[model samples]
Structures are given as C-alpha cells and as structure tokens.
Target: MAEKEPPGTTVVIHGGNYGPSSQQVVCPNCHNRVYTVVKAEVSRRTHIIVILLCVFLCWPCALIPYCIDSCKNKNHYCPSCGSYLGTYYN
Candidate 1:
C-alpha cells in the first residue's frame, strides 16, 4: 500500500525555464506530464513602462505596453488540472 501525504502538506516541483510561452512540466496538483498554459499578465516592469510613457509621451501611448507580450509577465498553469504553476517575469 502507498503512504498518503499529511494534510496541509505541500509538494513543489521545479521544471525547466518557463518563459513567455508554454512549457512542459509535471503537474504538481495532478501528477501528469503536460504543457503549461501560458497567460500574459501585467507586471511591475509593465507598470513602470506605462507610467514612464504617460509622463514622457501621452496616456494613449502608455496603453501600448499592455498590448505587448514582452512587456508582461507569463503565468504558467497546468493544462490538465488548471492549477497555477509559476510565473516568469519580464
């Protein structure tokens, strides 16, 4: 028989470099090998760029950073179970 983990215990599995795109990882929640789903999110760098653009250029130009993937953070999620994996900062 297999021993069960204690309640409230956490398991952390580290994978390879998780960049702005999807990556393969062993899902910590489901224990499955799958590609992570990539989601772009606003980050500190993005916010700083937006603030700088608004002060130097204009409000409309500040919005440009929002549309650029390189200016955002990449969130990795398990495609199988939809559990949050990790984040890659810009």
Candidate 2:
C-alpha cells in the first residue's frame, strides 16, 4: 500500500522508486544514463550530497535559491526529453 500525508502537514519521503521504469536514457546536458535508486541508503546519501551542495552554494548567495524553481513543481523536467531531473526543495 502507498503512504499518506496529513492535511496542512509537511512530510519527507525518505526514498522510493521514481522515474521511468525502463531502459535508462541519456541526459541531454551530461549525456549519461541517469542513476537509479537501487537502495534506499544510497538514495539518502545522494539526497544529502545535493542538499549539502545547495546549502554551501546557495546559502552564501541567499537562503532560498532552490525555492525559486520549486514553487512551480516538486520535480523539474527537461523540456527536450521530458526526463525527471530531480526535486527542487528549499
């Protein structure tokens, strides 16, 4: 069964399977097969890396740089291939 979030409450999805469940496709920018989350621990580690990078860079610039893009959608998609890049949370 799927999980649920309460109304007017914030929740964090620790890890889950996402993206196209088929052969990997190349990223337009990097031209690399996107990595899949085979293990929840691995995904958590990657999430930490991204958050740390954003905090290090954006925190110096401003407190909420990621929020600019996140306000629209949770995950940002590529206009060219329509691939799920990642979520934008600030």
- Which candidate should be chosen as best, given lDDT against the real structure? 1
Model 2 alpha-carbon miss at residue 28, Å? 6.4
Per-residue alpha-carbon lDDT of candidate 2 for residues 1-90, written as tens digits (9 for 90 to 100): 986867865332223323322223345455555442221122343445557767778545343333333223244344445655554333
Error at 81, model 1, angstroms: 1.0
Q: Per model, how many backbone clashes are there?
A: 0, 0
Residue 17 CA displacement from its true place in model 2, Å: 19
The 0-to-1 C-alpha lDDT of every candidate, in the order given, reads 0.84, 0.41
Residue 3 displacement (Å), model 1: 32
How far off is residue 53 in model 2, in Å? 32
* Top-scoring candidate (TM-score): 1
